[model samples]
Target: MITEDQLTSQEAIALEEKHGAHNYHPLPVVLSRGEGVFVWDVEGKKYYDFLSAYSAVNQGHCHPAIVDAMNKQAQTLTLTSRAFHNDILGRYEAFATDYFKFDKLLPMNTGAEAVETAIKIARKWAYEKKGVKEQDAQIIVCENNFHGRTTTIISFSNDEGARKNFGPYTPGFIKIPYDDPKALERALIENKNVAGFLVEPIQGEAGVYTPSDDFMKQAKAICEKHNVLFIADEIQTGIARTGALLAVCGNCTCEGHCERQETYSRPDILILGKALSGGAYPVSAVLADDEIMNVIQPGQHGSTFGGNPVAGAVAMAALNVVKDENLAQNARKLGELFRAKLNEYIKDSTIVNLVRGRGLLNAIVINDTEDSSTAWDICVALKENGLLAKPTHGNIIRFAPPLVMNEEQLLDCVAIITKTLGDFEK
Candidate 1:
């Protein structure tokens, strides 16, 4: 019976390898603790956390305000199962709907669940409102999009690893090339049953593949033209990760939520998760105006722990941290500096190709084939050099530090990254 304090990193890794499901291929280092933008391995070595748990910790790890809110609510009440209305659920709903400027919200526990919820809502809207024949409502998705791993989500995914044998995959989804508004319009014109056009404003899992600047605006316009819903999955790109409050907000620079600006391409259905709870609890939500959201009636959809009191408290606190700390503005500022510095370093570098992304959610492409291990090796070196990052889509390494990170800390991490990459230069 070894206590947590008595376990070593090797011992912990072995235990997981032996007992846990082999779903994830995590980095070799075993982190024991995290705060702000830094994490500590079991051996007490500290490193900058450049991944920020896939941007789930945008408010930063172990944020006191969010944790305190969770603690206070847990002490009083935790779960009510939606059988009876809890005191805090309404308040959270009101606050969140107001904060994000949505007419209603449907809470869930994970990003996948929220995405699933949005799909269901879209399908229902298609049948009841759009008059698409039942079971024939088709939703449009993009190629190379990483929505989630659920059965329905993977049904439309291009990732062979996730979709291979995961089916007979779910059906009624139309797939098209991403970042192409003309393709989107063609799809809508070809299919009369397009209930919604589901897209990631900036594709995060596809190695941070950012679309053109006007992609969102143009797509929204096309969806409007065809009366199809414009759904934005902001799970990984939301909560100020992309310099804006939501990636769909486009170039708006307001510190907090504001009236829908000309730069903003408001989604008909907004799917959010990750930073919603500040990494303190599992909280995800689907938001829309009443005309769209109201389609979900009693017993049609829900989760027992979806709107639990603790999640409600933690989410409100987390959103406050984003606004009170001015994280959106900070992410915008630091992200510019980070890219400029990295661009300067990669000028004559052969191992690195180019940097691409919006705000802090950026990635650097390793000058190697997708099948090559150079990107993974560079990440391992980065870990050894007191920084942590991971590769995506083979040869691309995503670098998203916590939004709470200060300028000095960001520069320090930048130095560590550049130095580590130098070790892998051809």
Candidate 2:
């Protein structure tokens, strides 16, 4: 019973409160339009978007190329479903497989779905190909991992809020401390039926926690030695959000590098989403070589809108933007600049304990406990200062802007962040 002309940000929030389930605690900003690295609120106030919709909009709010592809594809053909062929699916499949250097791709619609698909594929491969027993197959996942929110995916989460009432949880997932190769090694060795090691190259939702240097290389080697599939949940870290296309692409000893030797450790199974469609559409994918992917027969798995023509076109344009624009390099350079600026502020401030992250995916730890409202308060202050960011956990605010941001805009944002934190106690 509301008119469009009369709707304000407060009115919109009120409407959502009345009608929608209160699942999220969001900043009090009603954004209505976006382009490149910024969004406009309902009142026409502008702010730099820092979270990028959980790293889904790495190509920025709506890249012209991706939107154009989506629009063009919609006009010509949208969904033919996986039951039949589509003109764009094959071309897109070929493009994506080559881009990621994987032999095959299994498309899906969301990050969680892709993670689920990877789990199913790994379990099947373990039983049929690797000679593991049926229900005893185990997948090793890191602590503080945030894959997605499906029932099965949430089953393995260590976060109390994410897993509290969502059970009886799924089983067969073994947990190990993240960034510790020794823990993963012991888990794999002690458990003879280990089927896969599922990990995030860089933990995103866990306040952008990054792993140790040489951890990925050592873990990959262990998985290979044990004949277990190395499943990387790159839903948040992939597609150039981190420098070099993946967070697992640099050297840990290089001060600010990614530290993962790409040549030494290529994951057997890769799960991707978020930025896969440049935030233009929902597109997720699981990738593996044919030997592993072919284990599932035709009837074993499928989704109706998984590889539709529109998704195919959108994903293609998104991936192309990542490469064509060199967003990976841009993110890396900008990340260094951002961290430097933040760290400079951290030197004198008692409000922030630390700043950690790579590329554009970063987080600042508030000088408060997990139950503190400081992070939320700081985010509100940031909104007032013309920037938008959100807290992950209670005292941890994540700041992952789109890779399309420029240096001047980034510095402007840094100034806003510093000034806001400066005025927190005043």
Candidate 3:
């Protein structure tokens, strides 16, 4: 074993800086190991992981069951490249489809790839099934949505930073106001070539901005009436992260009562990623019924690593963790506790404006300009206090710890957050 003094956090960070690309602006701490809701740096300093790797660690980091499955599959078979049948892929497809209540599953490698696949399917369905003219099919998307980073995906993005140099973007996408059902209806009614409405159930990357109550259901209804597909991007909020197996499963109502009622909101096309492999492997998938998914005739859509044995096994175990441990209920319970505690702190503090989220996928709005450093400064202090979290947009900090975190651990974090925020003087 490496000695603590010899393997310091700073030394590890320096090594990364020397060799790795500067794509992410991570905290100055270097993570070496993780389990449950906690992670340790190379120097053996432990900290509560509040961001959950952008909610990808919902099943906790390096879950033993998921890891074991990956190891077993690795020793047996890793990839068959979808050329020949793999033992685990079909089983995983059935398992995932049944779990999400979909008829078919299109496995992919990353969240972006899943999003891209859904777009292709929606367009093809529009043309083949809905009789929309080729090259004229249009899909409706929300403003400020973080679908992915591909050229086509970024084309419709409202953020200049994401689109500045990437332009001449792919067309055929219609932009609409988020959280407004009326806007969606108007667009669908006005556009004869409307194909589908693609949106995030809860926009995680856009500072965890959840929409109005009845937004999703109403959107689904409109899509049905207009013969349009309602595609949900649940990459960040799916798999029990939002307290109910899926964020769309719970009522979109802002009222607290909806959490009690077991409502299963279904989307025509469901995209999932991030925690699909319990942070053990890169796995993503899009689930849909047969009619819609059948639009793609093989060779049009496939990935070399989409349904490999390793991915299949890891995904199964990761999903089992969610179902077996009742992570949905745990997240729901902890979310309530978290929001209640944060609301109490929000009463008088000028630094924190408000807290809003469905389950553990929540964010706190800092009362400052969009470019303000208050959120970043607070995060630095939180790191000093032994909790690791980061700001999303300039002034918003998302707090999503792993679902395996217990009440005692959560309270300790709450205390740390309250103290850290309390010390910041306006």
Candidate 4:
């Protein structure tokens, strides 16, 4: 193994460019280490992590409690497939189900896997329980949904770049306008074979396009009216990243009592990933009451490393840190402070149009057109000024720092961002 001290930032990026696939157009900052709300470059320059691995490090980067749990579990026991029961799987299932208020949990290894699992479960539930014809059950999805990059998940995506050459797409999905109750109700009313409506509580990959305050609750009501399942893909919004235990909880702050809140519209199917391990392990899960989850029988779906010992320990520890540190409440306070700061700058900025988001999951619309390189350039400048952020398609730059950020650090980041935007003022 080559020591990181011997590698320059340019050398490391060049190596990745030559060896790894060019699937992502990353900003030119090579992060070598992360702790709390900050990360370090190979040359030892520290920078605030504005993106937080696309909200996957909500508990902050490399938290010692989480790392320690993983190390201990790795040394003790790591893997054992479902062929035979493992010691930690049962504990993880019970702990997580209770934590999220679900009846059962099915483990997976990635966000995409968990999404695929939910789709399968929804389809199976449709056929087995809902009296839908086999292989004909349809799931309603939003037009600009960004569940994952898997072939099937991308089938319904409107992005030309992610869909262009990938063909032989999966069928059985109907698209509707996001955040509109009328559109959702119409789809369910028109499609008698619809089984579920999958949605992100807040559309993170779609430039943090948070819908109307009533969109989630309204959608759930519509689904209920049609006996359709309301599935929430919370892979990017869960685990206190969105100022609540779950975004679907609205303004709820009580540990995990989302179902008790008047605004909470509990999902028939809940998918979680990303921060489940605090970015320490590849852990994801699909949760539901027994009635929905029981559709998956033996040999229907399984991942070799899904519910292994290390994942269980890491996830449990990661969740504990979120609760112990009050990351959700912290995110709520910091997000309000961040948006207020940005709004003040945006009023006078020629480089930014507006800012919008809930909690730390926010975005600034560049004053430039969608096709311009201004957002990318601003990001490059931000990196030079001691912060790291990336743009979502076109001119929208998302700002999602780790939930561990304090008011002082948030203010510092807000200053860096506003100054960077000013540098591009027309």
Candidate 5:
């Protein structure tokens, strides 16, 4: 039994090792508090939080507005288990539907659950509306997808670590290489029973694999050509993380979903999570127009805490903060500066091969191979230099700070990052 007084980072880690599930590999820092763009370790050491908890805290850690909304709602009604009507759920639903420009929204509490919800919706729509034979409908997903760790979601994943022992895997999914529109075209054309083509506008967990510039537009076109539902999993890349309202928002800055923007590739179905609640609470949502969404009848789908009052209030305030603060515009301008700065150093560095990403969601490829520890070692050095980032795969370190960050803090972080990488020069 551990005592409550002055537990060191080491002690906290030890306690976690003793009792917590060993499912995640995390950095050694033990953070106790956080605010915009920075977190304080238990020892009161401050560091730039570059990961933003995998882009979930894009509004910044412990954002005042989100916290206030959550606190205020907690005092009223927390949950009614969907058995009774709550005053806040309708207002939230209307707000979210207008924000995303969808006729309906299906709310869940996590990215994974939202993804599962999308899959079920698409399949049901296929059978009931698209005229595909029951149980024969297949969804086409990109390779290296990190939607969620649910059994059904992982069934389509080729990630051995996430897939190895978790089978007999669920079926009805067809996999294709990401960023290849021709392959997607061929797959859709060849398969008559395809229900949907699910993809990440920017594949986040898979080393931030950004597809070709025309990939989204072309994929949406192909899906339209064949009547396949275009499902975009923006769980990691959405909510201004990629410099736009969504990575699929393309060149639009119209303060809305950008359905009018010709450059935007509006998917038939959209899945969102992460920053939806500004990391204050769990809130995920799937959106579609009436023709597609109305297929799910009353008894077909539901969740206990999915559309609760607290989640409702938290998500509304969180989204309002995104627009009111102009985080999307901030991410776009700073993303350009960040990449340009890193590229300048990368030109002369032997430890880094390249840097690629949109908005603040960027990554640097280490000179070492995927199995090398060079990226891990460099991250440790970064922690010592008063910043925190993590590797996605083995050799790629993702640097996604909260969108609330400004120019000066970003440059300071860049200096810390470049200086740290300089130590690993070969």
Candidate 6:
């Protein structure tokens, strides 16, 4: 019966260990508060948040504008299940569709749900519009992609850890090597039943494996030639996390005004989550033009809280912050500075191999074997030194701070990161 305020960090950890599901292996720090680019441990020590909740808080923690919108909507009207009409859904739908230059959007609660919705849409479009036989339509996915842990998503995932005991898996998916346009082209040409090609513009979960600049553009071209839907899962890499509004925008620095860039690759179906609500609420969406989105009718796919009033209000405010503050531009500028600073330090370093990523979403590979605990130990040291980041794929440490972080804060974080890595150097 101990109150939350009275519990120590160890006590809180112990409580979660006993009561919570043992799915996530979190860092030992027990955080109690956050603001902007920083979070505080229960003991009151402050640390820079480099992970940004897997790029969810790209606008930063407790972003005032997003939080204000969520709070106001929560006080006024929270949820009016899809069974009935709400006051804010239509306005949000219109605003979002225009913002992203899509003809329509289907709201959902989480990244996995949005991905599933997009899959369903693609399949339906194939059956009804593309003349593919029902249930015979196949979606193409890339290796090392991490869309989500949902049953349908994991069915196509090559990550044995996620798929190990979770079968009989969902079929109708073909896996191809990532970043290889030739492989993609071959897959599409070899399979006429392919309905869509689902890919992460930059593979964020597989240690921020950013592809070549023209990869997305080429993939979209190939999909277009084959009449396949090019679905971009920007759950972790979108919303200015990769310097652009969406990773599929390539190197365009037009911020959120994608119309100014002709080189950007527009996906047939774009799945977005994480930063969509600026971490204030769970709001994910699947956006496509009417030709592709019209496949689904009422009761075909939806969540009770999918397009709730609070989600609509919070998403609009969150998106407004991205454009008004020029977060995409900031991420682009800071990301260059971060990689430059790290590269300078890495020239003489032995324990660090290389840094790869776009914009604020970057990762450094430890020079040790993947099975080595070197990266994890370095992260533990980083925590003690007042910065927070996590290791991915064992030896790769992913660093994604909020886009709102200032140059001064980023330089300070870089210093901490280099100093921490220096300790583990051979």
Worst 10 residues of 5 by lDDT: 251-260
Report how far off residue 271 is in candidate 2 (Å). Answer: 0.7
Predicted candidate 2 versus true structure: per-residue lDDT over 17-125, tens digit per residue: 9999999878899888899999988888899999899999999997999999999999999888778998898898899888878889999999999999999999999
Clash number for every model?
0, 4, 0, 0, 0, 0
Model 6: per-residue lDDT, tens digit, 8-75? 88998999999999999999999989999999987888999999999999999999999999999999
After superposing candidate 6 on the true structure, give the runs of residues whose Cα lies further than 4 Å from its correct spot.
1-4, 255-260
**Candidate 5 C-alpha lDDT tens digits along 219-328:** 99999999999999989998998888989987566578756677699989999999999999999999999999999888789899999999999999999999999999
In order, what lDDT does every prediction score?
0.93, 0.88, 0.88, 0.91, 0.92, 0.93
Candidate 4 lDDT, 1-426, residue by residue in tens: 236467888998999999999998998877788898899988889999999888889999999999999999999999978788999999999999999999999999999999999999999999999999998999999978999989999999999889999988999999999998899988888888999999998999889999999899999999999999999999999989878999999888678865568878899999999999999999999999999998888999999999999999999999999999999899888999999999999888888888999888999999888899988988999999999999887999999999999988899998898888888887
Q: What's the true lDDT of residue 326 in model 3? A: 82
User: Which pairs, if any, clash in model 6?
Assistant: none
The C-alpha stretches of model 1 lying farther than 4 A from their native spots are 1-5, 255-260
For all the candidates, what are their Cα RMSDs to the real structure?
1.5, 2.9, 2.9, 1.4, 1.6, 1.6
- TM-score per candidate, in order? 0.98, 0.96, 0.95, 0.98, 0.98, 0.98
**lDDT score of residue 3 within candidate 2:** 43
lDDT of 1 by residue, 187-251 (tens): 99899988999999999999999999999999999999999999999999999998999998887
Q: Lowest lDDT 10-mer window, candidate 2?
A: 250-259
Candidate 1 weakest lDDT stretch, 10 residues:
251-260
Could you tell me the lDDT of residue 372 within candidate 1?
Answer: 97
Q: Give the local distance difference test score of model 2.
A: 0.88
Candidate 2 lDDT for residue 248: 62
